[model samples]
Target chain A: MKAIVHVQLKPGVLDPQGQAIAGALASLGYDEVTGARQGKVIELELSGTDHALARERVEAMCGQLLANMVIEQFSVEILD
Target chain B: MRVAVIVFPGSNCDRDVAEAIAQVTGKPPIMVWHRETTFFDVDLVILPGGFAYGDYLRPGAMAARSSVMRHVLDHAKAGGLVLGICNGFQVLTEIGLLPGALLPNAGMKFICKPVKLKVTRTSTPFTGSFTKGQYLDIPVAHHDGNYFAQKDELSRLEDNEQVVFRYENNPNGSINDIAGLSNVSGNVLGMMPHPERAMVHGKTRGDGYKLFNTLMETIR
Candidate 1:
């Protein structure tokens, strides 16, 4: 089984990296890009065959360590 | 009082803090490496400033999960005094020992300078010697020092007097101008300022020296 986690800064949280990226894009003549919020995607390989259990484990991982719950939100996707 | 300073792989301020503590307490603290799982018997545990784990993942994030932090958490739970400064403060938030998250500076730049801070209420294990509302100039050097928390938590910290220090001029855009915080039990404290870096021998006033004095006095 495999799992993927996407972690992003929560809405209303200021993202300096995203803002800087957006600025760079503007300087590079990509004026149409209004903003860009950077996030992380983590792919995990697990031995579990159960889809539900794998999803649960990944979500738990986000809550426990992968994501800073106070400032970021995370989503989990399971791949079989 | 017995003090222990935790040293993570990238911690650069461990000796500075240990020396500051020693100057005040008249004895050097024990240095515990990141791999240590036990804090041994100590009255206080300090997490000093530095780029722990090279600030990877997040400032203090990896260090917060190290074997040493597990022991630090246990110490705090047992009502031991835990002080985290600068990057150490970031680790405290990451470890969930302190509330809120420290984001990038609003201007998105690394700021290093002395800033004025008003002692909020004092009378805690960290600020027992300072007068309430006293203005202390402390040096802060970090990239991500902006403190943020939900509305309710911010107010709760205020209502409970857990806010130990507030910036006199809001240097990093931290919410509510919060510069330092203490756990509800008043045993754990995390702040962005580098109090240890400001200590100087004898002439009696550089700004950070007073903090170490107070910490040692409180411990005594």
Candidate 2:
């Protein structure tokens, strides 16, 4: 089993890197690009066979280490 | 004062901080590796600046969960003084010992320069020697030093007088120009400035000497 976590800054948080990306896209003549928000993806490999147990463990990981709840939120997806 | 400077694998300022402590207190601090769980006979614990864990995952994230941090948290709970500088400050926030997160600079550039700051709170042991509103010239070198917190929490920090330092020029777009802060209990302080770099009188202004000097005297 594999679990993928998407971590992103919360809505109100300022993301300078994302803004920079948008600026770069505009400079490259991609005028239609309105904005960008940067985040990170973390994939984990699990040995467990149970999907439910894997989801629970991944959620635990997100809360403990994968995401900083103070400024970022995370979503976990399981792949079999 | 019996000080202990915690050295994570990538911590580069541990020796400078230890040297500053020795210069101020006349005793060199014990250099404890990140794996060490015990900090016996230590009154002040310092988390020096550097890219711990190569800033992996996030600045200070991996180091915040190290086996030794559990003991550091215990020490903080027991009213021991903990000073976090630059990357150290990031670790404190990551561990939830201090409120707020340090985001990358608003300009998205690694900033390294000396900036003017004003001592906002002088009641804590960390600032006991300075007059309220005293100005300082401290150097800051970090890529992720912009501080962020929710509006309500920011207000609470201000109301409680936990904000100890404010940048005169708002170097990194930190909310309210916050350069340093103490926890509500006033025992743990996390700041982005590198005071150790400004501790020598002839080579530098030695503006940071008062901070370390006052900390020792007040704690002693």
Candidate with the greatest DockQ versus the true structure: 2
Off by over 4 Å in 1: none
Candidate 1 Cα RMSD (Å): 1.7
Best by lDDT: 2
Q: Write the per-residue lDDT of candidate 2 for residues B45-157, one digit (tens) a residue.
A: 99999999999999999999999999899999999999999999999999999999999999998999999889999888899889888999889999999999998888988
Q: How well does model 1 score by local distance difference test?
A: 0.88
CAPRI rating of model 2: high
Q: Over the stretch B89-145, how does candidate 1's per-residue lDDT look in tens digits? A: 999999999999999898888999888899986767778878898898788998999
lDDT of model 1 at position A24: 99
lDDT (0 to 1) per candidate: 0.88, 0.93
Model 2 chain B scores worst on lDDT over the 10 consecutive residues at: B200-209
Which predicted model would earn the best TM-score?
2
Candidate 1, residues A1-80: lDDT per residue as tens digits? Answer: 88888999999888888999999999999999999999999899899699988888788889888999999999998888
| lDDT of residue A52 for candidate 2 | 92
